[model samples]
Target: MESLPHQYSVSVNAEKENELETTAPHLPTLLVAPPSQFDGPGDKWSPEELLLAAVANCYVLSFRTVAGIAKLDWLHIECTTDGVLNKVERNMLFTDIVTKVTLIVAEESLRPKAEKLLKKAEQVCLVSNSLLSTKHLEIEVVVGG
Candidate 1:
């Protein structure tokens, strides 16, 4: 049988006054509804923005994680994500998320490996994978330095 890869779980709990709390492997918070400017006070992040930020942040973090695991030295890193919401078919809601990962390495030969690492990171990124199967997702990796 194939062995299991590294795994973890995140949990979210709701508390008083329409507030939500996230726990376990969760890297971010779940703000209460009404949404700051819309009504009540909460974090400045919206649910949609939260999703994008999570995916983008997770991709970059995953890359660094793998790079460290692979014992590769790196320099600068930047990740950008754009989510486009459009109508699918008639009224169906859809989203297309595109991510650009730019990595600055110490040597030119590391470009290929950098791309490989970024790809692997994408495959394993929990948020990215979740969104990929749900909607159209594309990623581009550019290496420099």
Candidate 2:
């Protein structure tokens, strides 16, 4: 079977002054990362940090898409993600990512609908599926406060 949508690119250049390009004409910048907090070597973002962000960002995008598909109207949305890095097998690498999504809807009645959107978001989350084990997702729907 073939994927429905195809053709996408994210270009990153260490020597290009943190410049990038995206095939999606609608997208402005490809994406930017300030490298690691520890500045010693490696001119690019660390693999672990990239993994964490990828999972995080992918879910957020997925959530938004799902919300629109499910007819969910929201005022604000915030999310946080965590990846547990450890040594698996003989080499050291990432283990899993846990994403927490906080959704604020326009009205209290939309909370349940928002929750359903989150579920669909998880389903289309490509980053989550790339991982090996289950990635724990914590979703919260807040009405006003």
The best candidate in terms of lDDT: 2
Can you list the residue pairs that collide in candidate 1? none
Clashes of each: 0, 0
**Candidate 1 overall lDDT versus native:** 0.69
lDDT string, candidate 1, 42-143, tens digits: 564555566788888998888888998887777877888877656677862335778877777887777778778878888778788876435333444444
**Model number with the top TM-score:** 2
lDDT of 2 by residue, 18-76 (tens): 43332345665444444454352455455556678888889989888887777788988
In candidate 2, which residue ranges exceed 4 Å CA deviation?
Answer: 1-5, 8-44
List the candidates' TM-scores in order.
Answer: 0.63, 0.72
